[model samples]
Target chain A: MLKIDNLSVKYQDGNQVLRGLSLSIENGETVGLIGANGAGKSTLLMTLVGILLPLEGTIEIDGLLQDKKNLRELRERIGVVFQNPDDQLFMSSVYDDIAFGLRNYGMSEENIKHKIDYIMKELGVEKLQNMSSHKLSGGEKRIIAIATILVMEPSVIVFDEPSSFLDPKTRRRLIHLLRNVPMTKLIATHDLDMALELCDRVIVLKDGQVYAQGNAKDILTNQKLLEEAGLELPFCLQRIEL
Target chain B: MSEIKKSINRISNLEELTYRDTVIHRLPPVIKLLMTVIFLVTVISFGSEQVSGLFPFLLYPVLLMTVAEIPMRPLLTRLLIALPFTLFAGLSNMFFSKEAAMMLGGIIITKGMLVFVSILIKTILSVMSVLILVSTTSMNDLLYAMLYLHIPTIIVLQIMMTFRYLSVLAGEISVMYHAYILRAPREKGIKLIDMGPFLGQLIIRSFDRADRIYHAMKCRGFEGGVIFSEHKKVRTTHWLGLMIVSVVLLILRFVNLSELIGQLVIG
Candidate 1:
């Protein structure tokens, strides 16, 4: 339901980050974006979210927000989980962090509390409601970050390195949590296994261009293409026949 | 820098140690902030020469600070840090005093002390009020309170964005500083002149970082202000409690019993 066409971005100093990169996703589809460090994955995501205006190109969400005039309406419709929970969460308590979005939307107090409870329960993070961000474990912090966006109940969810620092078990749990989510998801990560296991489609981003895009099975089985794009194959995917 | 980090850790823990189960923490930050303003306005409304009148007014902020469990020493230390500024401004009165007031035991005092004390008390009270506000409320909560109070959207966005960018800038600068420290071995610290390039680079990178952050927000469909679906409306009793505290403070400010006692004790 989201379409980005020939998007480009440059810093004020005129350092180009994203060079005419185009990407799209359907409703309820989990699309994996793989790139090396500084490949402009984050830049592309930010451009789509309206956090950064593109230097060129058009972004359209079908049957969704069409223009900048209804930005508040549009923002409320998309959820972004930032790479660092520390930066995303600026609240004193976990409950407050999750409730921050609701407060921004000016939701009624009862509804705010209800949404927080429901999201926390779904994430199995009910016990972290009163805990400070300083006291949380890295895994718990990741979950809390997810709750911050999930509580908003946006139509599209964009996650930037959701499993970056998580441990294996925590990463698995997180993968499960992400799998259960029913929104259009655009995940940018270097984790090939996660991309293979959790995404229906995989797109390789190399040097600010889309190098390859196809079904998960087709993309995961191509060893040479994965290596050329600086990505390794998942062992499980490698064991399967093409 | 390490010392600062250690002290931050120490102070945050110490602050956590002396928690009081008071109603103040439960009050909405905007209401508490307004009450502090009202208390200060009442203090300023009284004649500056009326030292006794201002003495009792001290109890409002003092009692609140004490009962609210705000660490008095730190609050006072912060106040003392800014004390010299007020003192310098007040020192001007020493040179030009046209009026002298009657003093006890054939001693005479100028209107300067009266004005000076008013300024001093006013400064202490206001600083304490601010300390207590931050102590009781989180910075993020205060920002949210400001938003809910109908503060202009752009200002709120600026505040939030500034906070987000501060650490990003700090981290970049800190890394540069660390690299310099490692390479340049010296018994003495790095000179201010040595920091010039680092500072300049940081400034350049920070603006670029802000641009990136803006794009990040936009990609998530953030057009202007970030919005969410859940918010809890504050309860009525919370409002009632705030009004009660403010009204009581208002009543106490007018009745100049403290001033009477100070005058009687001196006379």
Candidate 2:
């Protein structure tokens, strides 16, 4: 399980971004975090992954307290997929990018290759193993970015806008893939329809606080709660005047 | 301006060429890198008046180009980009050093003219050789070879990150330029008055983007060390290739193969 309790993050100017937010995700659960702009969804995800040092709070990953001593292991266990695949996929080739994290852990090259091949195969991106990351189509790059994280064998996978730039077909494929990934997933996205399809639970953030949380179907379908959180109903849930 | 777009495309093309699988591309980066250094030093060591001596070194770039299958047009295009500086330097020698070295077919061949030709040849060979090395070896392999040879990690990372972000930086500039042009279609490029603010904004934007990239890298366990998971070890064949190339370049530098061949034919 992954846990964040009373987490607070502040910028250098001392403006708090995540305001004492607290949440916990059980093992093998997929949770969708939805919010409008400035709702602190991305900030929360960044803080959870240790990018933003929380001013006050605790983060525990699988019974491991997140301190400077164990931060490396915590990072290895919780993979983050950034909004831009270009930023995360820094290596020259897709294979190298995927192998980067594994190399940091000092895994033998033979084991690294095996693990990468397995992950790419699982993701159905075997052809992309040797291709340059920069050359990939946006959708392909997104999938490969996921592959890079998945190869690390993180216990929990965190995604920030996984389906933002994808076409409808690619979006469907990604949703399908995420649905089958059996691990804890924290996806922060504005794509409510995707959240509805892939998430078991959903949390809505407003003004850097969790305004609503419950079963995915109930919270996403609750029109009043979503409106108060500065979001519209998911496309599938909205009633058309026609 | 289209300058950013052209530059982005050129970088993309050169990087793409590195992905090809060929004999030259398969050569170990360390050996290839060593050969390039030796080739460059040998090419530059030639005295300005020894124009004929530099002629033989042309074989290295020419052979690599042919064997690596790098198209000539782009290669020469990049070569021409470096030509002007050397051209200026060589042109000055034309006026200052005008002692006639020999008579060729009843025409005066001045030492200064020889120096000029020698400088031109040196520029072409050096640029072409470096381009070939970059085109044939992927950036990761080259950087890894540098690390293997104990080049400071800081310098390699600086060079690598600068290269990796060039595309991102170019994309941002292209967007900024597009927005500027849209707002000021009457002007060509940024107005001189606007350049200050324009560049200032770019610097700020670059810092913001750099912060994000650094965060992403750190999240992936970057600890100031380059983690290259994919590397081909330097093997015996690579060592042999290095030795052979070095011997050949050195022999050409001193033995004057042309002179010896001409003597043999005449005798």
Candidate 3:
């Protein structure tokens, strides 16, 4: 389980982004975090991964509290795919980027190679193993970024803007892949259709606070709430009676 | 825009050449690195007027390029980028030391000109050797060799990260430049007064990107140091290759093969 209690984040510039927000995500659940620009969606995800320390709150991943002493342990159980694939895929080659986490955790070479190959094959990116990360197409890079995170086998995976720059075909493929992954996922995205299709629950954030939380169908179809939260109802459900 | 694109292409081209399958490329990075160091040391140890002694050192890069199937054009182009500084240093010798050192037919070769030629030769030999090493050895193997040689992990990590981020920084700058140009199309170049904020924005963006990269790395379990999982053992052939290259370089350093050949042909 992942839990955030009264989380408040203050940036170095004295901007308090997240304000007393508390939420809990159960294991094996796919939750969609929908919010407008600067709605603290990215900040929340960053805080979850311990990249941004909250001013007053506690974040626990799989029962391990987020702290300097428990950072390694907490990070080991959670993985984050940043909004920009370029930031996530830093190593020269795709194979090295995927192997980075395994090596850091001191996995044997043989096992690391095996895991990387398996993950790449699973993601249908086996041919990109030797290709430079920066040379890959945007879609290919997004897949490789996910592959890098998935290979680590983190229990809880967080994605910020998972479908931001993908084409229709690639977006469909990514949605399919995300649906099949059997782990806890918190996806922050602007693609309402994707959030509606993949997530079982939705948490709407308005100005760094949870405006509403309920079933995916309920929140996605609520045009009034979504409009107030700086979002809109999904096109498919725009005409459907709620 | 084209300049940025060309630079990004250069970075990729250098990396792509290292992936070629060849005998030189197959040589272990440690052995190749050691040979490069020895070649550079031998070339620079010659007297400033010993241009003939440095001629044999050319064979190292020539043999490697041919055997490794590397195109000489790119290497030469890169060498040109490093020549201006050396040329200035060589020009000073020409101006300051004008005493006659040798006779070519009826014309006198001044000591300064001879030394200048030697400097140019030394520069070519040293730069080409280093370029050949990089072209043939992948960055991964190079870092591993550095670690094997007991180089500080921090320095190796710096090199690795800098190389990895070069293209990214280039791309970011290209975007910023394009944005500036779009808003000010009539301007030929950024004004001197505007350069301060223009560069300041680039630096700020780069630092923000670096912070995010560090966070991403930390999320993937990067804890202060990098661990390479692949370990390659030195083979017997690598040792033999290293020995042969070292012996040939040492002989060239001490013996003037050019002078010997000239004497045999003309005396």
The digit string of per-residue lDDT tens for model 3 on A1-242 reads 99989999999999999999999999999999999999999999988888889899899888888997787888889999999998988876788889988888889889988888898888888998877788899999999999988998999999999998899999999999999988899999999999999999999998899999999999999899999999998877777776
Which residue runs of candidate 3 sit more than 4 Å off their true CA positions?
Answer: A239-242, B227-229, B235-237
lDDT of 1 by residue, B174-207 (tens): 6666777788878255678876887788788777
Chain B TM (all candidates): 0.76, 0.94, 0.95
DockQ-best of 1 and 3 = 3
Angstrom error of the Cα, residue B86, model 1: value is: 5.0
- Sorted on lDDT, highest at the top, how do the candidates line up? 3, 2, 1
Writing each residue's lDDT as its tens digit, candidate 3 over B1-267 gives 469978988877787788789988887889889889988888889998888888777777888899999998999999999999899999999999999998999999999999999999899988998999999887888998999999999999889888878887898888888888889999987878889999999999999998888899999888878555365678997889789878877887777899999999999
All candidates in order of TM-score, best leading:
2, 3, 1
Best-matching candidate per TM-score: 2
Q: Estimate the TM-score of every prediction.
A: 0.73, 0.94, 0.93
Query: What level of docking quality does candidate 1 show?
Result: incorrect
- Indicate the docking level reached by candidate 2: medium
How good is model 3 by TM-score? 0.93
In candidate 2, which residue ranges exceed 4 Å CA deviation? B263-267
Every candidate's CA RMSD: 5.7, 2.1, 2.6
